[model samples]
Target chain A: EADIYQTPRYLVIGTGKKITLECSQTMGHDKMYWYQQDPGMELHLIHYSYGVNSTEKGDLSSESTVSRIRTEHFPLTLESARPSHTSQYLCASSGYRNEKLFFGSGTQLSVL
Target chain B: AQTVTQSQPEMSVQEAETVTLSCTYDTSESDYYLFWYKQPPSRQMILVIRQEAYKQQNATENRFSVNFQKAAKSFSLKISDSQLGDAAMYFCAYRSAIRNSNYQLIWGAGTKLIIKP
Candidate 1:
């Protein structure tokens, strides 16, 4: 099993609250990604990072921001949570392009 | 921009039977990669198989295999002797092999596979 981990597998919060989703991998992979998915829906990429100090927005426009200050960590933060932000957030890492990704179990978020 | 599509929203197969899931993608890049990921009841995404666009041969792993038609822009997965553990959501994904590209994955909406014992 991959050593990657995502804290708070599930969370329920109210509107206007600020929250951060944590993702960490012990494999020392240089690439990391974040995706948003709804039940039975396709996953939408929200953010990705090539390495430390490198971050890019994904195909889907999102209100959340991400940071990659350490090779083992990539955390996502929402300035203000909304009901529309309710969804599952998945974290993944890969060694190189076309390489298989190691994904976390995922964090399921619900905003009221 | 690249896009992956899985037309089957859901599928069902009897235990020990064979089943196939379809997928198609749009991309201008000559070199790319396609993948099949399974999300079980635990909701963890697991890699099932992968195929490189430049390769003429298809890819297979254990009971999972892919029928990759590059010119047709199609990549379909076939599961032989499907088991109850195969019940899950399957996603098709695309990624450009270009070094400068985002390397970010493009995903399909996914198909929910049901296995009947």
Candidate 2:
């Protein structure tokens, strides 16, 4: 089983609320990624980190930001949430390039 | 640019029957990886099977098997004795094997598999 974890399995917040989605893994993986997905849709990569202190934006443009201060932790924060930001956020990690990714349960965020 | 295509948006099959999900990819690189991932409702995504470009043999795991035609750039997943647990959104992904590449996977839109009991 994958050791990755994402907190707040489901979240409902009002617009303009600042929120943070937590992601952590115990497998000591060097590559961590955050993807946004809608119901019955393809996953869109939002952010990824190769290792500590390294972060890059993905193909999809996202208003959220992420920080990789530690190998096990990568958190995404939204300064001001909007209804457009409501979507399922998934966290994944891989040990090496081209390796299969292990995913977390995902956080479903809803902004009212 | 590499692209993965899953033409079937949704597929249905009777329980205990067999079903196939089609996937095609466009890539110029000869060496790369292909993957099948399953996402159950309100659950995490998990790897179901994978096929390497250079491998002539198709990859199989338990009830799941892949028909990989590298020449046609087609990779299809076939599930035997389909079960209710197999109902989920299946995604096809492709990753380039070229060195120095970021190793990001290009994903298909996904196919929703429904097993009718």
User: Chain A structural similarity (TM-score) per candidate?
Assistant: 0.97, 0.98
After superposing candidate 2, which stretches have Cα over 4 Å from the reference?
none
Model 2 chain B poorest ten-residue lDDT run: B96-105
lDDT of each: 0.92, 0.96
Cα displacement (Å) at residue A57, model 2: 0.3
Considering chain A alone, report the TM-score of candidate 1 relative to the true chain A: 0.97
Candidate 2 accuracy as lDDT: 0.96
Q: Give candidate 1's root-mean-square deviation (CA, Å).
A: 1.2
Candidate 2 residue pairs that clash: none
Docking class of 2: high
* CAPRI quality band, candidate 1: medium
- DockQ for all models: 0.78, 0.92
lDDT of 1 by residue, A46-67 (tens): 9999899999998799999999
